[model samples]
Target: MNSVVELRHLTKVYKSMIALNDVSLSIEQDSIYGLLGRNGAGKTTLMSILTAQNFATSGEVEVFGENPYENARVLKRMCFVRESQKYPEDSKAKHAFANARRFFPHWDQVFAEELIEEFRLPLNTTVKKLSRGQQSAIGVIIGLASRAEITFFDEPYLGFDAVARQTFYDRLIADYAEHPRTVVLSSHLIDEVADLIENVIVIDRGSIIIDDSAEEVRKRAVNIVGDADAIARLVAGREVIHRESLGRVASVTMLGRLSSVDHEYIADANLDLAPVSLQQLIVRTTQEGPVDPSAAATEVRSVQT
Candidate 1:
């Protein structure tokens, strides 16, 4: 697959802290990428640099094979829908959409109108007066209607209810099918977007922990359930990510594929195997010490949207 965006040795720093450390990755064209990570995991910083909203401390970034900084040619081909988007104090939702139409050359007014009705957004109300969920809907509408070559949605469903979020997801899938493009979505709700993302990138503590296809990532770990002693012996040499015990029964999540011998042992021990979901796998992979209390604050101050 052709890469629409490339990051080479990308790094970001805030005073004494490193937000992104020697990161290198590629965003393939015409696919949905899930940027899964906890707060202060550099997801926003990476997106900010790609969109030219923020500059990398060091290293290189290429969007559509060219530097995105101050480059209208590249910038116009990408859209960054963020929760912190700002609007004129007096401007209504209509004004925002109209402005978006002007900025996004491929903007579809018809689609925007359809989304407005579907989201039941109030066009007359000033953006500041609208509810948080309603405000988020504005960004979602622009993201879908803009139809940019590479769109970045950074936690776009901030305050949305389950139904509203599902609507966004359903529309995203439907529209993406009819019009394929590169989409980089950053969200904390990992499970909710699991089915939507074709590729998964897990960032942890300023580093890339897992970068692979969703299907492959799902297969990276397996959960074994049975007698505590059997599970302990089976997983003795394996990398255990998570474990649970209930009296004599133990459930353990371990990395790497099971071999024929291991399978036979599991069968002999009457053990059961369960598939790991994307969310659970990610949680276990990134589970560690508490994040720096100042990391989130620094990112908030440094990141531009």
Candidate 2:
């Protein structure tokens, strides 16, 4: 199927607060997707509903063209890895793997063993006694080894050091290359995984603010650096997301691609072009509004409007 997961008007309410407000979206097959948003933006709530870990107040949810709630067939094909994943006090890492092997038909024991060693996890240590990083490693190992068709990793890298995080990313890419599946990862480390995601889905205030290909998303904004006067002239009559200045030189990030006229303006004005960071774009768009940097020194000024 073209869409592996679909949600129609999904809504979840906890007393007075609306966790998910009539949200609707779809996930395509065999690609890595980044689910990004501020805390309480309904990101975790949305993924929880998709995995049947929680119930939606109102909506139609489908996985693999079938309702996933309580459906063993669909559940077995999916996996949800999160920092808060708990195991029994007496259970060890091996116990978790043993359970995963039984539940997931595609579970790969050899791969799991390899990951266990790579992450340097103690197989015999009780779950409760393991360090937070070690606990997170267990989740990572299970998620990767499960080999489920649709895996949701909801910030499973908590407590992971820089090296460990990079290892996870490297292994993830290599494994995905060999066995493609739909993977949706939610992380606050935007730029770190920016190169890994094919599609970006952003949620803000319980709603989807941006959903598009990564390439298209990055193209939404461009940075121009040169003399302050020339930069000002270049951005005239255009939407400016941010502007930073140092002495006479300035860097302005705006929300549009260059036109023939704009190109002429850049060349004639001796301006340099730089790529915009995907994280910065999302941060600007999701903020209450553009923030004008302080005039004390060189910084950014968001030209709203």
Candidate 3:
């Protein structure tokens, strides 16, 4: 896949504090990507720069093979739907949609109306009067309905309940499969959208820490539950992302996939292996601090062989 967005040594600074420091990465075209990191990890800053909503202090940024800053053609092809999205206090949902219809060349009124009904949104009500979830729904509706070539959703389900959030995920994938586009989603609810995104790019302390396929990333760690002594022996000198004990059964989440021989060792030692979710892996990875991208790749390969 070709890179629709590219950043080379991207850096963003404010006063003395650095929001993004020497960050560089590429977002593939027509692919769903998960842009994940802890709070204040510069996820928003990265997206804002990509969509031309903010300026970069240094380095280069390109979207759709062109600089996005003040480029009408590029900006119109991209839609940024974020939790902190703004609307006029007196404006109604339809007003926002009307503006969207005018701005997006491929806006689908039919699709937007269907989404409105599904989310039970009140069109006539003032955007400020609507519940937080309702306001979020409006953004979701526009994001999907616009069908722009590139879309960035920064925690789009901020005020959404469980069911409403699921609706967003379901609709996003359904629409994406039908109308393929480059979609970058930044969310703390990692596991929920784990299956939807094909690639995972994680930012830590304003740096690109991990960038790889979701499947490949998942295999980086494995959880083992059984005898603490047996677990201790297996994980000796290895990195343990997490660990807990319940009486005699000790659960340890260790970095690196269990090789076939390692799995056989665990079986013989009466240890049980549990599958680790993408969210758990990411959380552990972040907690572990500034993971070396090359080391992660090497570990993935070492365990697989």
Clashing residue pair totals per candidate (backbone < 3 A): 0, 0, 0
Models 1 onward score TM values of 0.93, 0.90, 0.94
Question: Cα deviation of 140 in candidate 2 (Å)?
Answer: 0.4
Superior candidate under lDDT, 1 versus 2: 1
Give the Å error, residue 10, model 3. Answer: 0.7
* Model 2 pairs in collision: none
lDDT scores for all predictions? 0.87, 0.86, 0.89
Per-residue alpha-carbon lDDT of candidate 3 for residues 118-214, written as tens digits (9 for 90 to 100): 9999999999899999999999999999999999999977999999999999999999999999999999999888999999999988998889889
For candidate 2, the TM-score is: 0.90
Please say which candidate is ahead in lDDT: 2 or 3: 3
Among the numbered candidates, top lDDT falls to 3
lDDT by residue for model 2 over 48-165, one digit each (tens)? Answer: 9999999988989999999888999999999999867988879998899999999999999999999988999999989999999999999999999999999999999978999999
Model 1, position 189, has a per-residue lDDT of: 90
lDDT (Cα, 0-100) at 298 in candidate 1: 24
lDDT of 1 by residue, 1-305 (tens): 89999999999999999999999999899999999888988899889999999999999999999999999999999999987788888989999999999999999999999999999999999999999999999999999999999999999888899999999999999999999999989988988999999998888978887778888777777898999998888877556778999999999987777767777788888999999998888888778533232221121111111
